[model samples]
Target: MVVAIGLEGSANKLGVGIVKDGEVLSNCRRTYITPPGEGFLPKETAQHHRKHILPLIKEALEVAKMEPQDIDLICYTKGPGMGAPLVSVAVVARTIAQLWNKPIVGVNHCIGHIEMGRAITKCDNPTVLYVSGGNTQVIAYACNRYRIFGETIDIAVGNCLDRFARLVNLSNDPSPGYNIEQAALKGKKLLPLPYSVKGMDVSFSGILSHIEEKGRPLLKSGEYTVEDLCFSLQETVFAMLVETTERAMAHTGSQEVLLVGGVACNVRLQEMMAQMVKERGGIVYATDERYCIDNGAMIAQAGALLYASTGQPTPWDETYIRQRYRTDEVEVTWR
Candidate 1:
């Protein structure tokens, strides 16, 4: 069996995981939590990853009960994230590959999420809704690529929620999105917010701006609680997501809808997507936070698939990270 260890630090969370074939042996992650209303900066997030990466890697190895020499390849997320954080983990991957004398693969971060979702859920050739802090897209495999059928034209869905949390000074403990979900549970009213959907793409920046303006006076006057704003935002934004996903499903004639990425963990979004798919005699495949959010195991899984097909590692100079790497840029060799 081909064994690989993956390192992921493209965002705030630092993760390490081991995968053999399609099975995940271990997935470990440590998130960098900032104070209330504060967001993680790229430089600081990179520093956090650098500090905790070694321990996390050791922990993953122990959990997998495998030594470095047992691993055949190493993988790291090479793109679509903060430059500093991507480089932080890339440096570590290079070190490990050279020390262990194993081949290395640089996997696309978005493709990593999709591949991991498919592997864990066993949903083959499903339409993927990848919603996260940095990305929001409806993807489907076609013509040797994961083509984007729909996406956000402005800010991503997760970024909209996180920024709203900051406006309300919400705790960033578990996650801004998680906090919003909880607050939404207690919300009884749905305040009006802008909903912009052009063709297959969504726009969230306008809604965020509208909510900030409406929420400022209401919050100060005690006319509306943060809970109401959270509820309204979730309802409006998730509806747009569901609508766009439904359109993609209709266009692609897909019977399965798979949710991947950090924001995919939201129960409300899942419920909305499920309801929409159910009406069309389809099913929605979603995983828990472990597989949904950014992690190393997914990277390893995607890298392993590509490695199996190509039987080659990325050249030392070509392993550098790409900040704006698009999902279509990655050729789906395994599929």
Candidate 2:
């Protein structure tokens, strides 16, 4: 068995996965909440990665019943994430690759999510909707690349949720999305909010501002509950996503939709997407927490495919973190 170890510390989460022959043996992650409450601080996140990544990697390796020396390859996320966090993971991965004398491959974070969704769902040629704190995009495979059919013009969908949660002093533990989802379940009112969609791209900045403005006045007057605001926010944002994704599928002539990213784990979002797709005689594939959120398994899955097909192992000298890498910039070598 050709074993591969993967590391992902691109955001606040530290993940490690072990895979052999395209099958995941173990995948583990340790999530870190921001200290200042909302939004990630690059320097702080890097420190967290430095402190927690080693233990998580060790735990994953032990769970897989393998050592660093037993691995044939080491894979790490290289771009489309915060620079400090990405650099932290890259430094560790390079050190391991050098120490173990193993080949290293740097994988795109977004592609890792898509590839992992494919692996988990066995969905071939599905139109991908990638929604996260840093990104919101509609992707489809065509020609030799995964094309971005549409994306957010301003802030990401998950970012909107986190920001809104922080605005109302929601729980700072775990993730704001979870807190928002929980609050939404208890909510009774549906507050009207803005919905912006242009051609294929979507925008949430206006909606976020509107929610804050409306909710603040109501809270000050004691006329509305926070739960209602949370519920309204999820409903509006998720509805926009459903509409745009459906439009993208129609344009691309795709019968399958794959939801991948940290926000994809939201049950409400999944239900909305699944219902919409089912109505159109299409299928929706949603991953659980393992692949939905950032994890090392997806990195290994994507890297192994790239390595096997391209026969190009990443050089330690060329390994660097890219904060603003675009999904369209990468050419997909694996189908």
Candidate 3:
């Protein structure tokens, strides 16, 4: 079996995971959380990863009961993430590869999530809805690539939630998005919010502006609670996502919908998707934070697949970070 160590620090989370072939032996990570009403910056995020990556790597190896020598391969997220944080993790993976004399491969962060989701849920050839702090896309496998069906025109869905959380002074400890999801649960009223979906693409900037500009009055005048605003936001945005995904499903004639990414952990979104899928007599698959959110195990899983297929390592010179790596760029040879 191929033993691999995966490194991921694409954004605020620094994760290290060890996997033997397709089995995950250890998954360890540290999230860089900012104070309430604050968002993490690239410099600080990279610093956080640098501070914790070594310890997490040690912890992961210890938990896996393995040594660097036992690791047959080292894998890391090559990107579609913050430049500083991506470079920081890449530096560590490169150093370890040289020190351990192990083969190394650079994996795309999005494919990492997709591959891990497929593995954990055992859902084959399902349409993917990827929602995260940095990205929002509806995708499907076609022509040896993860083809994007639709995507955000401006800010991502998670960014919309995170910024909204900041506006309302929500805690970013666990995550601003999680806090928003919690606040939305007690909502009793459906306040008005903009619904901007142009064909398959979505736009959240206008909705965010409307809430920030108009919804504040309702909150201040005691007409609407934070819960109400959050609930409305979630309902409106999730409806758009579901609509676009359904369109893609109809076009592709696929019966399964797989939700992957950090926001995939949201119960409301999953419930909404499940409801829609059930109506169409299809299934919806999702995973909790371990696999849903950014983690190194995914990188390891995807990397191991690539390595197993090619029997080769990514060259040291070509292991550069592509901060804006698109999901459709990587050719899916493993499939």
Q: Which candidate is the best by lDDT?
A: 3
- The local lDDT score (0 to 100) that residue 67 gets in candidate 1 is 88
TM-score of 1: 0.99
Off by over 4 Å in 2: 35-37
Please provide TM-scores, in order, for all candidate models, with all chains considered together.
0.99, 0.97, 0.99
Please identify which of the two predictions, 1 or 2, would achieve the higher TM-score against the true structure: 1
- Which residue pairs come into collision in candidate 1? none
Candidate 2 local accuracy as lDDT? Answer: 0.90
State the lDDT of candidate 3 residue by residue for 67-137, as single tens digits: 88899999999999999999999999999999998989999999999999998999989999999999999
lDDT of 1 by residue, 1-335 (tens): 78989999999988999999899999999999999989999999999999999999999999999988889999999999999999999999999899988999999999999999999999878999999999999999999999999899989999999999999999998999999999999998889888899999999999999999889999899888989999999999999999999999999999999999999999999999999999999999999999998999999999999999988899888989999999999899987
Error of 2 at 72 (Å): 0.9
The Cα local distance difference test for each model comes to: 0.94, 0.90, 0.94
Q: List candidate 3 segments past 4 Å from native.
A: none
